[model samples]
Target: MSTHVEGSTDLKYVSDEAFIDTGVRKVVSKGNWQQQYMSLRSFPEGDRNCYKIGVTTGTKYLIRASFFYGNYDGEGMPPTFDLYLGASLWDSVKTSSSSDFTIDPEIIHVPQKNHIHICLVKTSHGIPFISAIELRPLDNSTYQAQTGSLALLDRLDTGVSTWTR
Candidate 1:
């Protein structure tokens, strides 16, 4: 059986209430969005906070993390933080401004164990927050990384004009 954690059927996102105990949930003061992005879990206390997700070992998966500041904290200044996959540094998440829509970071990785920890580390720029996280299993043969995991640099869609999730 697959060891991955299941999300809500309608939204396909695991509830933070069930998976994480830290951070207070805050709703966006502006913009109309789906239920997932409308609210976020903000970590204001800890230096590092993580969400542990179960996945099958040796399976190739596309893990995506989304951040939307929306000035949820009432502070106009957006925060800059670091994202880590376990002990390895994934990327530094920077928000240009509080009005910025969303920043989505994606990585393709094969776990060495049965679970993976997605951690957000505070960099003192602002409070760390996350809107959504998704894990989708992929075929092991595809996206063959020569040495380490692959991080998405850019994604372009030709035809679509309007914003999409």
Candidate 2:
């Protein structure tokens, strides 16, 4: 299930209400260009909250998680938390205090099981929250990792704009 439900014609989003029994849905105080970033799900009570996604075993997929803190809680401080792929530690989500700055962490993984769990662990620094999560299927031959999953470090878009081109 997805935390946010807005989608374009090419994509469709479903609610996470049925998949998760915790967290509160909130809208960001500041406006965002993307509709999905306007709303988020925050976990306050639980030490860890997870969203389970079903996938074909051995299929390669790109999993991305987005976090945008538009000061939704009225507090100016942005929280730092841990993100987990199943039981393994994926990465740390360090959010900027700037309302416009969005942190997106992506990973290319092939799950051995039928379901993959994307979990958010609360750190003492702040509460854990998530803006969006997306999974894109990839060809088995693409993004071949030597040993384990590949975590995205940086992505550069070098294509020229229409006017420049």
- The lDDT per prediction is 0.85, 0.87
Per-residue alpha-carbon lDDT of candidate 2 for residues 1-165, written as tens digits (9 for 90 to 100): 543344554545667676567899999979655777888899998899998888899999999899999999998889999999999999999998886799999999999999999999998789999988888899999998888899998999998889973
lDDT per residue, candidate 1, 1-165, as tens digits? 212233444435557666678999899878765567778899999999998888899999999899988888888888999999998999999975546468999999999999999999999698889998888899899999887799999998689667666
Q: State candidate 2's TM-score.
A: 0.88
Candidate 1 stretches with Cα past 4 Å from truth are 1-11, 98-100, 158-165
TM-score per candidate, in order? 0.85, 0.88
Residue 36 in model 2: lDDT: 72
The numbered model that scores best in TM-score is: 2
TM-score of 1: 0.85
